[model samples]
Target chain A: MSPRDLAIKDLKTHDLTMREAARASSGARVDLLLIAEMVRPGSRVLDIGSGDGELLELLATTRGCDARGIELSREGVNAGVARGLAVIQGDADIDLADYPDNAFDYVILSQTIQATRRPKWVLEQMLRVGSRAIVSFPNFGFWRMRLDLLVNGKMPSTENLPYRWHDTPNIHFCTIRDFVDLVDEVGAGIERAVALDASGHPVRFNLPWAVWNLLGEQAVFLLSRKG
Target chain B: MSDSDTTSGEIRAFEPARGEADHPHSAVLRFGADMPLQLDAGGVLTPFQIAYQTYGTLNAARSNAILICHALSGDQHVANVHPVTGKPGWWETLVGPGKPIDTDRYFVIGTNVVGGCMGSTGPSSLNPATGAPYGLDLPILTIRDMVRAQAMLVDHLGIERLLAVVGGSMGGMQVLQWAASYPERVFAAFPIATAARHSAQNIAFHEVGRQAIMADPEWRAGRYLADASSPRRGLAVARMAAHITYMSDSSLHRKFGRRLQDREGRTFSFDADFQVESYLRYQGEAFVDRFDANSYLYMTRAMDYFDLAADYGGVLANAFKATKTRFCLVSFTSDWLFTTADSRNIVHALNAAGAPVSFAEIESDKGHDAFLLDEPEFFAITRGFIDAAARAVGVN
Candidate 1:
């Protein structure tokens, strides 16, 4: 059989529209945009777990930033390459630290900090290899999540916290405050911060700490070398 | 179905029937059905055929040729109609006209590795001597064996030297091997998102996948091929397990995250309630239908055994000693599987060996699967490298 036929068949059988697949999480691209904005034009950017190179392409097109991505899925990589993006198939846990120090202007780790085994170590490596970094993760301390856990007595499973107890890849779930404390402990200086609400709107128009954990549900941070 | 040689000895007949059916113009070519593959323990494989595919026209000089090697589960169909799944080639992004590899400018060749079941000689091929599939009787193969088989095919086409050789993952392993074993034969090498040796953790992952495939009840002691029953569930499970290792933890969070699949409420059962679970299940299910289970075992084993430095007196540079083949080693920042450190290791070795090499660790969020994506940085790098190499070799 021809590959075109197979792709068509697979598309028909397993075709989930972008909105359906992304679901309510489509707003996360806002976080991606925030990360891109952190980078200056001509700065080299590395998005460790780039999905389809969307953010990297955005950076390149919008800011003329040079971006490189590493993805693990053949289909995702193929999609990125189809869009004329450059992506390599690989795993981040085993591959990220191999990069030399100060190789990039900004190393963005958006929304994936919770799933890593060694987020602190990964962060340290990112700081070591790049002049600046962008780290974002869902705020497990959101009132809804805390209320869900307090009221229901189980691991919260909502739009942002959808995984069940057994199968969830969120190995290191943390709240906005917890991550802030982590950045301090690691001695990485915070340059700027933004926390978006569930509706994808910005929270804490002025002071970040006041509305970070209390009002805004999701947390996004920009960090740099402390010294 | 046959053509006769005229006085000029160049009698061309009707447009040769090409593709799937048993014909001369088929992309896949089968051989060694008569000989049994002798295993390490003296076990024997009766017969087998290897599947392969070719793209672009072979020029009169045949020197303007490039060979593409596929990763695990990839078949000979690099940029053509896949026979089983009937898909439109896997690397169409890099191999089409006007693309980086540029099929219009280079006669591209791709083929199934020795242990693959697509069309190349593999455990699934029939043993002509016994009229039975080779099964476990096929000799265990290493990266060198695959390269050797490919070398034979290149010779058959009357090509002296290749303009360039490219691949990623396991395919990159083959590219490295080609440069090491036949330095005089390749002009340029692109080994993306791959490593010189499998890490201990990666070996553990492969072991887990192998165990998964072997544990399936349908495996039936490797005789499942004859019974028309494959260890599909096991293979699916194995694929699902391995698929997780292919992405950055960041990618999973960005993609499935803690999100639920379909319904708003979690059913709270062991069923696929989360989007991640459903996604994994889909990956596994789709994989089994298009791939042969035995081929998985062989391919994974081949990946596990790839140790280029070990073969060259414990010095990775020794493998590339005195070779003029220009090398471009690319790594993604997020690809933990073969890390940028891995590429640096290759670069260091090439530097030590005095080989002309360039290394780039393109920043990307897509994790390890960055080379196949649409990163302009990667495209520019590839286009630059290929253009430079083409000029170096006087190809275009």
Candidate 2:
């Protein structure tokens, strides 16, 4: 079996103690694991575009956090709700404004920033509603994507960004550098950042922002509003 | 389980009735002088009776009881066969054994409101003070008064708190009233396709229906029952007009369109040429058979007077201040009568009051009747909300 399949199999067999330890340490995708580590135990969380509520479920079961989620698809909301998580069917672009300021400790938009109509406004709203926001997205400026465009003269489609241009939901795709510039423009500070390779493992630490942007297949950033 | 297992002290087993008119599953509980229902219209309703039906079994702790409020024309016939029409219950789509308001697990109760045409005490019920029907003499009832009567019924059933109060349309209005008036008594509330107050357009339509009923020569100023006569034509017209409001334009067009009724082409006369007209006539005729004109007026008026925020100094959030009851508000996109904005307004107020709330706007073309239809999304959301609330109340 593949390593991903093996990790999932191990997670299923482990009891609560082992499951909690595996979740707190590392088990699944590196970005999600990193996001889980940044969240404090027992804090309130709101996961926007929380497809199937995997992160919300993890936070609730492992960290004992009060987790809520807003998903765009009815099926995802139904699945999340059936698992006893407080998830509602709503659009991130429209429903985010309804939440009160500072309502959650952490607001997460994992792997969904590029699909938003107004990514900057959504990030700003996330910062307004949460003390800290965590965002993850596929890096469009990866070296392989750059090379594929240069050699083949076409939009690159990799495992992380696997959709064709016509059917892709990732409108307004941005690189890590572009996202950093947006964070600066929105008056938010990046508290921490992680660049994950193609195999869902973080790249070497202490790399400059430019090198990380070019090499990272995907990126996760922990952001907070600048006073 | 057998019938005996389903029977409890609060609910009797369903025994076959002697006559066709009697509801085998219904129980009529009377509130005499000792328990007078104080109305919002400054009148006391004494010696009144509430007709209700129970399904499933109420556990020993009674934390599994769910109270369902009926809409304007709905009665206590929620999940069983309707006695009068001999058809399935109104909410059978969502209240059967394995449905959203699952009768297999939780005990479900549906009550006829105070001012309803059903077995409940209303304008048709003879007043104890006089040897005649109350008619107009029956004090104009409000939504709060109906909820108050239900609370009394709940008290009589020995249930201190309801696991959830649920309903749609005017029924939903009663659910909100239950949450607002007896916040501590409701563990959860699901108010679907209803507004905090009746919109002016709704009141206008209701006024038109009321005018139609009163204009009939046989009405006799709401005393047709005493005169041994009925305003059947006027009531049917009123029903026909109101039925159009219950559906969306697309639904009507899809169901009837401009198709000729029982013919390839129209006769060109003023007869029921279109299928829509024939359908409305059938609805009107069917409605007049089971509904009373005076009771219809009273029910619509009750809905018109429902304004939770106005009662709480015009601030909707004040109505839900410190409420521990979890709420799930639902609205349909095609329900123009009670738009999604109304449910959102309620959600905002509940949020501002620090109440745990969830809202869903289901995409439907069925209009206000969407709540009563077999909408899968609505069913899933309802089941999820009820299951979560049941878990919180320790109902397994």
Candidate 3:
């Protein structure tokens, strides 16, 4: 049984709320121990906005990993198939360009790549189904969200940017050096980054990388594939 | 099962009645009958005693052991003091110290299983080579002889490996028989609400509570504690038919369905005209004032011969083939006697035994006693599956 155990057995069958289905489909709140140590224990994940599976039940409980999410929210794929997990809801910018490539050993995408309208064709269909992907977000050059949009210019309510820039869906806001120059303009290679800060913690990595490359509030990357 | 003991010279000799002195958090651990729990009918159970309670401090690398397992007439008092009804350890809601099984970070342990009578050893002790009591000579026990007497109490506490092994009903059948009988001696396994098998309507509601404790007559055959004759009304009608399978006919239609028990009308004949029959007659007269009617018929036939895929060959992922031991398996959508299709058949036999399983069902109207209550979404799916199996077994 593999399409990654039939996509985690259709994500155990979808009941939703990994925190509000990963904040109504990736607005964030996952970190389940750095996604169970970047999905290793028995690898083969894929997630990409999998809500209510809480990062596929924290990579099937701390990396005995064998996930399979996808999600757009059918109530977060029926609460991640009532906790038997193995999601699928669909529409990761046109159903993750129909799978089949590396097939997955990572893929993730937390906080839904700023509510994609095609964030680089859903990061090129999460780098064509996996050999590592990850991503995360919410940086937008943080320093208190660029001092609340350069002092009182609106849009940046805090507590991990709680909406209201005219009903915010956060149309792709970037940062950590514009997402490391969009993963070096699509070639892909980072292999780990992290960040966090604002009450979420993490940050330290021997400072002076220009004040955490402009006030890190939340980032996470991890990429792969290029070389 | 016949051997009445017949008031052997007017019985009543085993004592221990002080007062106000059973509360070092909770204690009652008499090893008694010189530690004899060897029985599978070849019989040899000298005297008996096992009312336990322990929490924290076993570590100097005794790999922070943990074992809770208590259900049909639970005992050992896991997180603290419960010396016979002084109350306070029926899994004091997911066990103490910052909960989620933290007892200040592990070394827990809880006894009372070999056909329980609060303390272990069972059939109401005493039989040192038959000087009396081993009612039907103890013997019969099975959740793998209660995990081979909790692996002989984790080899009397030298503890090799066990950072986790929790339980829920029949203490999740001894945490799925300690991850299918010592899969590398259990690293983590939760097993709430339970069911690796035990249906046929929960062994026909445990054969109507072991035929209402062998139809009482102060249950003489199993020697009703030799002669003070204690089948407390057929063990309070077998704890009121196993407390109506621990609730959820919509929690007895939202706690006490047919209402009226404190005088509303129906001075009605057979008495208790409702209020869930005076709350199942106060949960079967506070469960026969703290259990034992042949240790609730040998702990409901060791949770009716628990299944763990009928001991491997029938494949519940071949009892977790080639294990790494990480499973979670919870279920509650009003627990229809261990439902959600028995935790999706133990997550499809731990995904057809490739192992490494995790599952949840939650929702809850608190049936199958929602793992014993206050469920913050079943405590955030058990703190997100033990903080992702304690960050994948690094365990800090």
Q: Please estimate how well model 2 matches the true structure, expressed as its whole-model Cα lDDT.
A: 0.82
On a 0 to 100 scale, what is the lDDT of residue B202 in model 2? 97
Judging by DockQ against the true structure, name the best candidate: 2
DockQ, computed on Cα atoms, for candidate 1: 0.02
Native-to-model Cα distance after best TM-score fit, residue A165 in candidate 3, in Å:
6.0
Report lDDT (Cα) of residue A17, candidate 2.
Answer: 36
lDDT winner: 2
* Alpha-carbon shift of residue B223 in model 1 (angstroms): 0.9
Question: lDDT of each structure?
Answer: 0.73, 0.82, 0.68
Model 2 lDDT tens row, A76-156: 877676666666667889888988888889999999999999998999999998989999999988899999999999999
Worst 10 residues of 3 chain A by lDDT: A9-18
Candidate 3 lDDT tens digits, A1-227: 21233223323321122333445444435454455555568887878778777777767765677786766654565566456555544567875765656767788888779888878778866876677788888787878878887889977788766888778877887777777777778888775666666765445444543466565687676778775
Question: What tens digits encode model 1's per-residue C-alpha lDDT throughout A73-117?
Answer: 645555554444445555667667656678678988877888788
lDDT of 2 by residue, B236-312 (tens): 89999998999999999899889989887869799999999999999988887778788889999999888889999
Write one digit per residue (lDDT tens) for candidate 3, span B238-354.
788777888778878887777888786888489888888888888887777666678788878878877778676776777777788777667778888888777766765665554
Candidate 2, residue A128: Cα displacement in angstroms equals 1.9
CAPRI tier for the interface of model 1: incorrect
